[model samples]
Target: MSDRMRMMVVMCAVALLAGCAGGLGGGTYERAEARRAMTVDYGTVESVRQVQLEGTKTPVGTIAGAAVGGVAGSTIGGGSGRTIATVLGAVAGGVAGSAVEESATRKRGVEVTVKLDNGQLLAVVQEDEGEGFSPGERVRVVRDGRTTRVSR
Candidate 1:
């Protein structure tokens, strides 16, 4: 056998051995399978009440401010000016009334806290009873697209 041929055989054996040992350092040999897990955060439902608001309600602060301003504005004028001032006052009162009703309506709702299985917490205000969720229970969290929904 020629010296050059023997060297070539030795190099090929070494290369094969190196290839076999490539994945020995905690490296995975195959692609890992991905999985989906559910996480539920728990919170109590205080009350399941219906909150209704007329479409015409205005905010309270605006109404209160307008009332005070109108009263003050009325004081600045008398007689026909008073009539003008009263008209302005009536407009202001209507605005104020609507605002007050809106604020009151806005205050009616339920607050719930949901805890995810991943230890993340969320606070939610839901108008309807969040279906299948209870005050002290574990819920399965499922991811739908980009949003998370909880199920009992």
Candidate 2:
């Protein structure tokens, strides 16, 4: 494979990943932050449980890996050996890439158990990109539809 083709494969991989990625952690998606987003839950944070934010590895990662692997494998040999290498590379790359993408995108998240003012306790887990919330800190749980965020 030529350098140009390899570049294309990489670019395509990046573009594909960009679309499926749900963002590193927190951000308003498709909806304005204040649009119908009311303070659904106001509480004192009882605990901030640290957890891993697993990332989704769909077809994008697999396809991207296969493309790059195929390209790389094509350079291995001529005739049948090349063909076998390409196939093996694609399979290995797909698996490895999926894992790599997932690992790369994995982030720090927290299961925030809040003590609502009404004496009821509920836990909301969301990605924590440094949205500081300490135990006993007052925070707001804003909700719009199925989406929710914990913020100071």
Candidate 3:
């Protein structure tokens, strides 16, 4: 394939990989969570701070990048030179792809330390969906068996 075509494929793959990312914010929910009973606790926000939510590390990004790189590298030269280029390109692309995916999916998060009505203190971190929290604000601590989130 032509260099342009190969580049287009790579771009498309990256886009698809990005689309695979889902929100980690308080408002977002997985399908399985629908109608499932959850526990809720009332609390006052004791402290609110900004944090970074790390990106996902999935095989999809590495594999897609390697494939795109191998195809692009194959067009570089003839015979043995092309083979070496493909191998090197794949390796580099895989690393680059992983980084790109992580950077692209990374999000700003908030760490909310709350003082529950029961006198217990707990902290929860979740994507900062722009609904800012402040100290002394009333919030709800929602919990499922697997996860927890602080919401207003």
Best by TM-score: 3
lDDT tens digits, residue span 4-93, model 1? 654564454334333332111111122331354434344433323334323224334444445544554566578899868766865775
Clashes of 3: 0
For candidate 2, the per-residue lDDT at 13 reads: 79
Model 1 residue 129 lDDT score:
32
Ranking by TM-score: 3, 2, 1
Give one digit per residue, the lDDT tens place, for model 3 in 60-148: 78887887878877878988999999998888888887787788888999999999999999999999999799999999999987989
Give candidate 2 misplaced runs (Cα > 4 Å). 18-20, 24-34, 37-39
TM-score of each model, paired residue for residue: 0.34, 0.84, 0.93
Residue 142 alpha-carbon offset, candidate 2, angstroms: 1.6
The root-mean-square deviation over C-alpha atoms between each candidate and the true structure, in angstroms, is 31.6, 2.4, 1.5
Q: Which lDDT values do the candidates have, in the order given?
A: 0.45, 0.78, 0.88
**lDDT tens digits, residues 39-132, model 2?**
5778999998888889886877888888888878888988999999999888988887788678766778888888889998878788877787
Q: Which ranges in model 1 have alpha carbons more than 4 Å from their true place?
A: 1-82, 128-133, 140-152
